[model samples]
Target chain A: MKIKVLAFGKIADILPQQEWEMDGVVTTGMLRGQLEAKYPDLKGLRYLIAVDKKIANDDSPLEDRSEVALLPPFSGG
Target chain B: MEKQTVNTEEKPSHRRKKVFVEGPISPAFVGDSIAKHSTMMNIGAHSIFLGQVRKDVIEGQEVVAIEYSAYTEMAEEKFHEIREDTFAKYPLTCMHIYHSLGKVDAGEICLFVFTSAIHRREAIDACNEVVERIKQEVPVWGKEIFDNDQYVWKENK
Candidate 1:
């Protein structure tokens, strides 16, 4: 299944926008592990995963063609 | 018999601008906005939160400035959502939020939040909510610039 990943802030700066197709991954945690594998330097970065604008935890399941956003901590005031 | 006529005239005049922006925010601009929005009849209280840059030594490096960037489309959408939510939850007359987009130096104003309401309590509560929502939802990033032209990314904690 293919998933659309939108990364913003520090994560976006490191990883460009693109689509990823995983053969067996189905959870946010799995996607995060794949991302960290691609960019080992981001291993310590803290981020939040959101599915369709609402915050999602690591165990959240992903469906085919799901829209996910990876966001770093925000500093706006 | 006498006939009478009614005269209807539409006058075109200047309207107040809602948002203001600059590379560096001027105190004069904020003062002007406060003066223009103040009135003796409707709004009774105003609450503001001003975020300023700080010079600190992090990891033995001296910090200098901050460079801010945002996903414009998404950031605006989030700002609108926060504004609508604040209005729905509180009885506020008006609110304004402005943040620096480019490079802002140390000790300079980076973010400004202003809210006005019929009473002090609502104004304070709305102001806090707006700031919290912006930090939690907005897609803005700040890069810390040090004295030696080196940089590090700053994350909200």
Candidate 2:
């Protein structure tokens, strides 16, 4: 199964812009765990995941071709 | 029941203007905005919030300055949404919001929010809410420059 991940803000700067293919990962938490293995620096950083534009939690189900955007806490005023 | 006259007079005008500018935000421009929105019969109180950059030591590193960048297209759209939402939620006479893009030195103003209302309470509450919403929704990024010319991305807590 293949899922598209879009990283933004600080996380985007850290991760390479490329899609990853997972055989059996079906949840956002599992995808995050796979990402952690590649980028250990993101271990403690707080992040928000969105399926499309709406915010999604760790337990949110992921389809084989779903689009996900990872974002950090916003800072603007 | 005693018949009471309904004063069908039109409510006063409520104007809102928001801008996202490059480089520094001119005080003259900001002052002109306030002047243009002022009226003789209404607007008894005006509240303003100015956010300035501060130089501090973070993890034993001395910070020198900051560079700000925004998804301007999206930010403008978000600003309009915030303005309309604030107007709908509160009774405000007028509002103005402006933020600086590009490099800003320490102690320089980066964000400014001003609101006018008939009373002090509405002005204060509206000002706070608008600023908070902007911080939460806008896609603006800040890069902290260290004294040694190194940089780090800033994240909101």
Candidate 3:
């Protein structure tokens, strides 16, 4: 299944713009691997994954066309 | 101000609020908000928290501004949840949260959190709690742009 990946904060400095399509990714781990491999800069960044607008703290399931966001630490007041 | 009020109607408890303000929040806007609340006779106290962007010298470079971004869908969801939880925990008449979306220069107001209640203690506590929760829970990120034309991502302290 294809997934929609969005990048934010410093992560965007690497992936820039996304709605990136990663093919045949079954889990968040698989998607993470693919992203880390494609953009090596992502390897050093500390961030979290949000599946369909919610943080994937666990091994959350992702379906086709899932909207994923790579979010760094929040600094808002 | 009207736009903000429209988005903050906590009718069903699941409805999301628009918390993002483009660029820095102006003093006029803040003043207007407070003026609008004057007619609410039940509110005895209103605690307001204004977050000003600081000019910090880091690595000998002066930070000029901060550009903020967010996962809007998730941020709104988290904001709504935090507001609801605060409402449940305190006896607040209403609460408002506004944060900058784009570039906010040093010394400018970037965030405004206001809570109104019948008592001063509840209003003060709710404002602090909401601000704390938003900092830790929301997916908004700020990139500090230095005067030397360098940038660094900021983390919650």
Per DockQ, the best of the predicted structures is 3
In candidate 1, stretches whose alpha carbon ends up further than 4 angstroms from where it belongs are A1-4, A16-27, A59-67, B1-22
Better of 1 and 3 by lDDT: 3
Error of 3 at B95 (Å): 0.6
lDDT of 2 by residue, A1-77 (tens): 77777676677778876334456668889878988998997888888776645568998999887777676776664
lDDT of 1 at A11: 79
Clashes of each: 0, 0, 0
lDDT of 2 by residue, B1-157 (tens): 0111111222323433436656555566556656665443687988998887778778989777778776555567678778888888889877777787778777777887888888999999999998888888877778888988888888765
Q: TM-score (0 to 1) for chain A, all models?
A: 0.84, 0.83, 0.86
Tens-digit lDDT string for candidate 1 (A11-77): 7778755334455669999989988998986788888887666678999998887777887887654
Tens-digit per-residue lDDT, B1-157, candidate 1:
0011111121111222222244556666567657767443588999998888788789999778888876555677677777777778898877777777778888888788888888999999999988887777887878888989988778776
TM-score of chain A of 3: 0.86
Best by TM-score: 3
Which portions of model 2 show Cα errors greater than 4 Å?
A1-4, A18-27, A61-67, B1-19, B39-41, B70-81
Tell me the deviation in Å of residue B114 in model 1.
Answer: 0.8
- What is the TM-score of candidate 3? 0.92
Every candidate's lDDT? 0.73, 0.73, 0.84
lDDT of 3 by residue, B1-157 (tens): 3444423242325456678888888888888888888777898999999999999888888899999888888898898899889989999888888988989999999999989999999999999999999899999989899977789989998
Looking at chain B only, the TM-scores across the models are 0.85, 0.82, 0.92
